[model samples]
Target: MGAATGSATPRIVIAGGGLAGLSLALALKRALADGIDVTMCDPALKRDPHGDKRSYAIAAAARRMLTALGVWDRVAERAQPILDMVITDSRLQDPVRPTFLTFAGEVDGNEPFAHMVTAGDLTAVLLEACRTAGVDLRPEGVKGFSIQGSRTDVTLTDGAVLPAALLVAADGGRSRLREQAGIGWISWPYRQSGIVATIAHERDHEGRAVEHFLPSGPFAILPLKAVLQADGTLQHRCSIVWTERAENVPTLLESHPEDLLVELERRFGLQLGKLAFETKPQAFPLSFGVARSFVAERLALLGDAAHVIHPIAGQGLNLGLHDAAALAEIITDVMRLGLDPGAADVLDGYERARRTDITAMGVVTDGLNRLFSNDVLPVRLIRDLGLGLVDRMPGLKRFFIREAAGLTRQEAPRLLRGETL
Candidate 1:
C-alpha cells in the first residue's frame, strides 16, 4: 500500500510506541476518527507494560494535552500535584542548606504548575487509550525505511513492509530512522549520571519538591502520591533524581544497600523523617542532543529523536509531549485541507513551530547544568546572588513559574490548552 492514495484514508506509521508515539497515535485517532490510520511499532510493547519504574514531572500544558486526549482523568487520582518548590545551593556536608529561592508552584490561580506520576502508571493509561482508540500497535519494531515520492515504505523487523503518507521516528535519541533519513544530530555527554529511586518516609512530603544544587550536580526530591503498604496503612513517598559525577556513579550503584542509604541520607536530610528506598535506585547517563531538523520529506521526528537535554530543568518529557501536540495539530489541519500530510510544506510547518522552542530549552538546560554543577566559590556566589534576586522579585518568579508550566506560549497547540482538535 502506498499511503491510501486517491480518496483512500492516509496512513501514518510511527516507529516507536513509547509515550510520545502512543500519545500521537491516540491524538490522531481522537481528532480525525475514521479519517486516518495510525500504526505504532515497537518491540517493547510485547513485554511487561509495567516494567519501567521511573517517574516524570508533567507540566501544566502537557497535563492539559493528556486531558484532551482523555488520558489524564484515568490517572488523575494517582498524580501528585507539586504545591511548592524550594531551591538551595550547598555542599553535601553543609550543616545547613540555605534556601536561595522558593516558588508557590501555581500558574493560573490554584492550578498547580506540575504533577508527578510514575512512568508505569502513565504508560499503562496511554497504552489503554491507544487500544481503545483503535490505534494499530505492532510488536515488531521498524527495521528501516525508504522514502518513495509521496510515501515512505517502512520495513519491520519481520520483513513486513508498510507504506505510509508519513513516517515518525519516536524511537529515541539513538534513532536509526533519523540517521537513515540523513538528519544531522549534535550531541555530547554531560559526564554525569542521574540516579532515580522512590523513597518511603515516616512523614508526608505535603506535595513539596526540593532541589539542592551541590558541586557534583543537582539532587532533586519530588513528591509522590501516598502508597498503601501490605499492613493496610498508607505510607508517604517521594521520588528522587540524584545527579552525580559519571565516574563516581558506578561505585555508588554497586555499593552495599546500607552504604548507599548512608550517602542518600547525607543529601536527603531529615525533613521527611527516616527514609528508605521503596525501589532500587537506577542510574542513567546524562546527555544533550538536538536534531539539525525535526522533519524531512515523508518523515518527521518526535521526542528524544528530535532533542534531548539535561534533566536539570525536568522539561524533557514535557517537551516531548509538546512535540506530539504540535505535530498532531499541524498534521490534522493539513489533512483537513485535503492536502498531503507528508508534503514538504506540511513538514516545514512543524519544524517552524518547534525549532525555536527546542533551541531555547537546550541552551537553558545546558547552561544551568554547567553553572550549578560546580564548586567554584565565585561562581557559586554569583549564581546564589542571582537566585536571591530573582526570588525577591515576585513578578520575575511568576514569569518563570508560567514558563515552566508551559503557559507563556500564545500560539500553543489546541490540545496543550486542553481543547479537542
Candidate 2:
C-alpha cells in the first residue's frame, strides 16, 4: 500500500514554498514517511525567509491542521488569538462610527475562531518542520512542466527535470505552472489596493479585531503579539489592512511618514492611544480570480494558483491552507489504497472536494465588497439594517462565526478536524 508501484515510491513535486506548498510537503512527508518523496521548489526559499512583512489570519480549522502537522506548537507563543470582533460602517469624515455587528470569537469552547501570525514566524516554523520531515527543499522554482501519461516532468529553473507522480502548483496567484497547463483564469481587478502595515499602539487591544467598512473598502485592525523594545519596554502592536482606491495608493506610499500616519489616524481613531509605524506600509493591488480548473492531467493547483479573492474577509491564506489539507488527504487516501496519486479519479476527487468551497468563498467576498464599498444612501441603509438584524440573531451570528472559523463543513479534511491522515 505504501508504494505506488511494486518497489517504487510515489514522487510528489510541489512548486512554490509558500504557506500552502510547505504545509502540503510537510503533511505528505509526515503521513507517508519514507513511502513517499516530496520536493518543494521556490526561489524565495533561497533568500531571507523573514523578508515577507505580511501577516495572516489563520482560522480555527487551519490552526487545527497546523497542530496536526506539528507546526502550531513551535509558534504558539507568537500567535495572537482574536477574543472578539466588531464591525462598523461609516463615512471617512464622520465624527463617529456606529458598530452594527459584533461577534465573540470562539468556535469550539475555548478555541479562538482565528489567530494572527506574521508571515515570517509561520513560514519559518513550517520550513523547519518540512526539513525535519525530510522533504527535499529546492531553492529553484519550477520553470515549466509537461504531463506524460501518469506522471509529470517538471523542469526547474536550474535546467533540471524531475518526473513525479504529481506536480502541485502552490505558486500563488500568478502561477506560471498553472498558465503552462493552459488553465483559464477568471479574474477582474477591483481598482483598489490593500495597504498592510504593523503599528505600535500605547494601549492593549485585549485581543479584539475591528473592521470598519468605509466607502472605499474594509479597514481591518487586527491585534498582534506584543514585542519588547530596545529600551526593554513591551510595545503593543496591530496589523492593519487599509483598502483604498488603486489610484490613491502611490501617493499614500510616497507620502511623508508623518503625513501617512495622519491618514492612518483619520481612520484608526484614538481608542488605542498613540500609533506609530512598526513596519513600512506596503500596498498590493486587489483582484478576484478563480482558475477554470483545479487540476489538469498529472498536475494539481493549490492556494492562490487556483483562486484569489478580495481581502475584505481576510480568508485568502486560510483558503489556500484548506486546499493543502484537502489535497493531501485525497492523495493519502488514494496512495494507501495502492492507486496512483495522480490518477484522473484522484484529481477529479480533489476538484470535487474544493471547487464548490472555493466558488462559495469567491461569491461571498465579492458580494461583501460590493455591498459595503459604496456610499449610496439606500444601499447603506439596507446594509446597516441587515447587519443589525444579523447581530440580533444569536444563532445566525454563531453560524457566521463558525463559518469564519472554517468549521462549518461536515466533510472537512482530517487535518482541518485536528486529525492525522
- For candidate 1, the TM-score is 0.98
**What TM-score does structure 2 among the candidates reach?**
0.98
Off by over 4 Å in 2: 1-6
lDDT of 1 by residue, 1-421 (tens): 1123577789999998888888999999999988999999999999777888789999999999999898899989999999999999999989999999999988887899999999989999999999999999999999988888778899999999998999999999999999998999999999999999999999989999999999999999999999888999989999999999999999998999999999999999998999999999999999999999999878999999999999999999999999999999998987887788888888899999999999999999999999999999999999999999999999999999999999999999999999999
* Runs of candidate 1 exceeding 4 Å displacement: 1-4
Summarize candidate 2's per-residue lDDT along 285-394 as a digit string, tens digits: 99999999999988999999999999989999999999999999998888777888988788999999999999999999999999999999999999999999999999
Could you tell me how far off, in angstroms, the CA of residue 321 lies in candidate 2 after the best superposition? 0.7
Residue 19 of model 1: what lDDT?
A: 88
- Each model's lDDT comes to 0.93, 0.93
Task: Give me the displacement of residue 246 in model 2, in angstroms.
Answer: 0.7
